[model samples]
Target: MVALRIRPAIVLFGDSITEQAFGVEGKVGWASLLASDYARRADVLNRGFSGYNTQMALPLLPKVFPPSKDNQEGSGILFCTVFFGANDACLPGERQHVPIEEYAKNLETIIGTIRACFNIFSSAATKDDDKFPIILMTPPPFDPAAWRKCRDLEEDGRANNVAKSYGEKVLELGKSLGCSVLNVWNLLEGATSPEVYGRYLSDGLHLNEEGNRKVHEGLMELIGKDHPSLAPLEAGATGEGLAVEEKLWRELC
Candidate 1:
């Protein structure tokens, strides 16, 4: 009997929230936790960049998924989670409020490019078993009252609303592209309150430890329900069976 070998590679790409590894202590970033959770079964690559928007990330996709010049065959990328748009919303001047139409175009480009790369590089047998699961995560809602304390309330509120609207549009686009949509805005809204996690936010935006956990848990639930391969591993269970626990402790400490 031939053994069915499963090789999973997850690439997490996004903004500061995806890049942050902060907490009171004994805590790891959600992406890192995700990596640790599947440490035994998969190779997780952290490609998250702080303050990167969709436009910026589109160009860097090749870096995360470089094609083999020698045409060497191996297990292709199994999953990719792209979370951008937050920084695009925060950009200065005309670029600040990225039009929903342009945002959709950028997302479509990213997904199309990835599909093209996989088709061009991976083997037919491997590609048949390896599904390219692209998960698009929307940005969580910003606290208007919190933003009021730092920046102009009216302007920030307007920008926040635009971001929310763009997020919804992005979800629609993801559906059109046959990708999974993780509505982080709605997920965080249900799991936490602005008054509670709002204080944990560093700069009227982005999450702290508790907030991060909320996002992570929401993601886990979403993935578990939809992706069969990820059902067994939970956020809290990672770093337990291997040397990851020690490393997690050191980093979190």
Candidate 2:
């Protein structure tokens, strides 16, 4: 008889959306639901820190790396989802927005750090040719109507505009670095309208259940096309559990 082996799971690093899995009952984040969808196939670790920025994430890469084994080389983490720049674009006089240059540097540091870690862990058996895949996802477009209703329009506009600009730069960086990039901003722009925003956003910025569902479906489609291993998320019944787990992690963290 032959034994079957499982591959290491993917890691998600981001802010509230990623942390949504840890929300209280009935308020699970979309990412958590996504995780549950994949539970039968691959392990999905959600490391979303609410209100965090790229600067903070750049230093947390080590925690996401897989542990080493005794007999064989440590398995590499399959996917890394980098979703940031939200808190960095917080309202004026609140959280300071990271300058474009600094943002780029932070992302570069993250990618470099991950690559370096993979090299150190996998160097014993494999060559540089075998490297884990990394995915860079841009933050979703800020709902302007939602912003106007809940926040100071002028201020929110500035922040959203700034964040959008920086988001584009991040996408460009991803391409240059040879990483797979998901332009979430573009995806959400046309799908959502002012009326939709009013209902799906709790505060014009963060998403409500409907908003989360929309993002989740889009994410599944994107992941399915690019990363078939993650397709299970598109059709699974563990969304509730995944949501609970996400909420737990968020609160505990």
Candidate 3:
């Protein structure tokens, strides 16, 4: 009897940024790029929820990544990206607003859960699965003017200053927790005026085509540099190419 060999999952867990990662209207999203890059090698699962904050994500963790011993569905998580805080950075009275301190704590809790689950699942499979890489992404730059115009509101629900605070916290956590960080905030806003940075966003809050490309490029760069073994296979690839489940048709022929 043959045993089941499941493809390892690259989980993109977060808020609207992740949820919309596959994209719409003929636009390709960062997650979609990953899916293509890892085609036939790994499953890239999008677990993004629009309007969700860290506080809301906490309760969903268990259900999303259950224990492997109980359910093999959670057994082969290659890695996951945590991208939240956009909605959480909303104004004080907003429904999605979570205090900065609480948001930090919530992120810690979420990471802890993933580590625990990954350890259990991988340890059962093999000792070589000792490390589970996690990438924490900071919220992209928020353009209050764009958001106000997009939403047609007197005042935007989020502010750049408030969002920046959240991104900083994510950076701190990445260092302390030894997780790779995709600093979207810096990637989009680095020393640029709002006029320039604002172009990356669609509704001043979400990513546009160029913005998605930036994120996809950043992710590919990180995986190639930091986790080269997991990078997709290509011509003349050395350490960058990960082995696929089966040989290519050309190889078989």
Against the hidden true structure, what lDDT does model 3 obtain? Answer: 0.84
Cα error of candidate 1 at position 143, Å = 2.0
Q: Provide the lowest-lDDT 10-residue window in model 2.
A: 240-249
- Candidate 3 lDDT tens digits, 46-137: 99999999999999988887755566554377778999999999989999999989999999999989888886665322223355688899
Give candidate 2 misplaced runs (Cα > 4 Å): 1-7, 21-25, 66-76, 91-93, 119-130, 144-158, 190-200, 229-253
lDDT of 2 at 27: 79
- Summing lDDT over every window of 10 consecutive residues in candidate 3, give the lowest-scoring window: 122-131
Off by over 4 Å in 1: 1-7, 21-26, 69-75, 91-96, 119-131, 145-158, 190-193, 196-200, 230-253
> Clashing residue pairs in candidate 3, if any?
none
Q: Evaluate all candidate structures by whole-model CA lDDT and list the values in order.
A: 0.64, 0.63, 0.84
Question: lDDT tens digits, residues 78-160, model 2?
Answer: 56778877666654466645767787889888877776665455422112325445778776656666677676565553345
Clashing pairs for model 1 are none
TM per prediction: 0.73, 0.71, 0.91
All candidates: CA RMSD in angstroms?
A: 7.7, 9.0, 3.1
